[model samples]
Target: MTMSRRAFVKTSAAASLSVIAASAKAAAYPTRPITLIVPYGAGGPTDTIGRIIAEGLREALNGTIVVENVAGASGTIGVTKFYRSPNDGYTLCLGNWPTFVLNGAIFKAPYDVTKDFEPIGRVVTDPQIIISRPDLPANNLKELIAWFKSNGDKATQATGGTGSTSHVAGILFQHKTDTQFAFVPYRQGVGAAMVDLIAGRVDTMFSVAANAIPHLKSGAVKAYAVTAKERLGIMPDIPTVDEAGLPGFYTANWHALFAPKGTPKPILEALNAALVTALANPDIRKRMEDVGQTLPPKEQQTPQALTQLLKDDIATWWPVVKEAGIKNE
Candidate 1:
């Protein structure tokens, strides 16, 4: 005897419920240690931030979170590793700005930022510093622009890498100033270039506040202007690059967490919650702020917000990248 239509529908519903239950069970996340991939060296800003978050995640998840450094090809090497990893929520990445965003524009990558991974949350943001060697006459953005015009290619600007955030900010500065200065890209980190700048090898460079703050305080280097729209609380005396001159020149870099695509939603939510807890701790905020960074608001700590941010950033940077004619090294 054939089953009636109602009986067939009931059987289908029961089977669907069983599949959902099995999936939920299989998503039993953090059954083992989770790998947090930091695509930079151990002590850099991105890696530092990743470690802090990983520490906090350990407390929240009650599971070991290992930070694996895979620094090469300007951070693309480790990112590629995560893209190829199993999407079982055990592997995630600390994707940070300038390198993450600008690199996407500069090179043809195996994984597109939009399509390849799932955003967990943004961690923090730090302003780029426009610091100069002590001997430069320019103390502000306008004066610095004028100096560049007069000096031309005689003066050099250094950056961590060709397509790094600081490099892009310098390119933006050049466009706004209508002047040209030789750009020097360093394979080593930006701090290495600080030595060159201090020695007068290069006139100036844009560095993250963490790298530049110590130099500024020690008078080793002079901060001409900051790319933050408002003066940082840590160094309020220094004017914004816009306040100094050239309106609407705000730029800063951020650190975001992402999981390999296809991580189960439950695991993603659990990870997001852990991140939110980590970033929300007052002590964590203080530690981050002491390093010249600020945690993103809780509202901005979601996969959806990160997805929109990536889209907006892609729109914002593609034109700039094209205009600058930036390409893979």
Candidate 2:
């Protein structure tokens, strides 16, 4: 394609204008209050993290960032609203392993998680724990597996919902231990499921450390083991999966920031930069850690790192979910 000098100059001028306009837009971003949707109910782990992130964002962006909770359908309800929101950097979704990765595989989500969002940054990590009703006979992960193997038919596992992290972790646990237990799906979230486990209505539940820490400390539920390589600082008595005789079975509930798809690159970069700055703040880091959340390394707190993580998780988990016949319907 050959262009005359006049045409070339016109095209160059247009390109220059676009770059300047984009830069201006980025600078004036968040002219209004932004909404951060927490896909679960208030007081849950996701909401807790979302509120903290919202506060951090308010400081980092020097703009108003409001957090709204839209619960149900394994977080699809809130995420769908986020998907439908305008891609003007005004609305964001605080997504995690379940809603962004597990839901796509297990349910017919209204939006495409893989294609319909722009990653801002990877934020926090909360390790999961395998806990049972206070009355469960098993005292440790090894004995728990043995008991589940013997009483698979009668055992019931509690989950946040059909495609939630707890539900998927339950399936993976069965495969690893060669045991099968009926799942008790709670539409609300794990808090509701935790109630059942505490009341002895369900046999076991895979819970995040943030949610399980209080119950474990209160002696409401029997803790088996944490699902990470390292033990949690708050619950030092608990052992890691490897130490608990379940090697290589690690599960964590991690979180990341996301904006609606088609958001401008400049706006995306601004959001990412704000998040990176907020994460580096000592107060934000301390608050997250106090709730049993662990922040990623500085190198991993970027749009590129989060994008690769989402892709890799989708590739790794979708096939496994399908092969196991795990579906919300």
Indicate the residue-level lDDT of 300 in model 2.
93
Across 90-158, the per-residue lDDT of candidate 2 in tens digits comes to 999999999999899877877888888999999899989999999999999999999998998899999
Q: How many residue pairs clash in each candidate?
A: 0, 0
lDDT at position 138, candidate 1: 88
Candidates in order, TM-scores: namely: 0.88, 0.93
Instruction: State how far residue 248 of model 2 sits from its true place (Å).
Output: 1.6
lDDT at position 212, candidate 1: 79
Which ten residues in a row are the worst by lDDT in model 2?
106-115
Query: C-alpha displacement of 208 in model 1, angstroms?
Result: 2.1
Model 1 spans > 4 angstroms off: 1-28, 198-200
Specify the highest-TM-score model's number.
2
Off by over 4 Å in 2: 1-15
